[model samples]
Target: MYSHLLIPIDGSPLSMGAMQTAMAFARDAGAEVTVLTVVEPFHIFTVSPEQLQAKRGEYERQARAHAADLLAAAEREAKLLGVRCEVVQVESDDPYLVIVETASKRGCDLIAMASHGRRGIAALLLGSVTLKVLTHSKVPVLVYR
Candidate 1:
């Protein structure tokens, strides 16, 4: 019953598992999948002006490249399944916000993402992005742990 599916990837194995789940759903529904990856914004306030500029530029470039690679992989998988798909790369410090915004902007009906399965101090330190997305996203979310 879903029209558009949004799958967020971070190049992690956990994220890949979520992608597989999204793929299965897409296959069943004959829905188009939009794969999104957010490249975090580079923080520059703490560094010298020159350093900030260089670091920011480098981070942007790396992010773009990484996103491209991930998108390509996702496309390959989708093509194999004979499914229509789109890839979107976003830049933001808050990946959850970016994911939700992109899903809304792209008119996705569902979001599929992986949980890192963090616990205790590790969870506190890392502050789960999946948790944020689950808590805030307006669309239906299918989290793959």
Candidate 2:
């Protein structure tokens, strides 16, 4: 009987699927949903200040556009399900931290997201955001595979 459910998505197929699944659950529970998309800041290894200045602006601009498109699509999905929806976009290097903080700040009763199955080296490189959220979140977390 959650009043507000937080769904975090990254536009991956698994995350999108989790969004759909959680939206259905929200509809059934008569709970409003908040869809969050967190964009990690772009990393650059170059030493040129000019390159850094130029590329950082472009990277953020595109990331913002992409997040907007992704959130808009999610809003449409929620509308189709007749579930009240709000969308949030955040930029951070630590996505799991952002997700947890957003859930607490928004007063979301639950955090639902996909368990992106990255293994070994890939997991190490990308970091298991879902696991981090599970470990750190005070709110309940529902993970969909």
lDDT against the true structure, per candidate, is 0.82, 0.88
Residue-level lDDT of model 1, residues 4-68, one tens digit each, is 99999988877877787788789899899999988766776633243365666776787688789
TM for candidate 2 is 0.88
Q: Which ten residues in a row have the lowest lDDT in candidate 2?
A: 45-54
RMSD of each: 4.2, 3.9
Could you tally the backbone clashes for each prediction?
Answer: 0, 0
Q: At residue 91, what lDDT does model 1 achieve? A: 80
Model 2 error, position 17 (Å): 0.5
Task: Give the lowest summed-lDDT range of ten residues in model 1.
Answer: 44-53
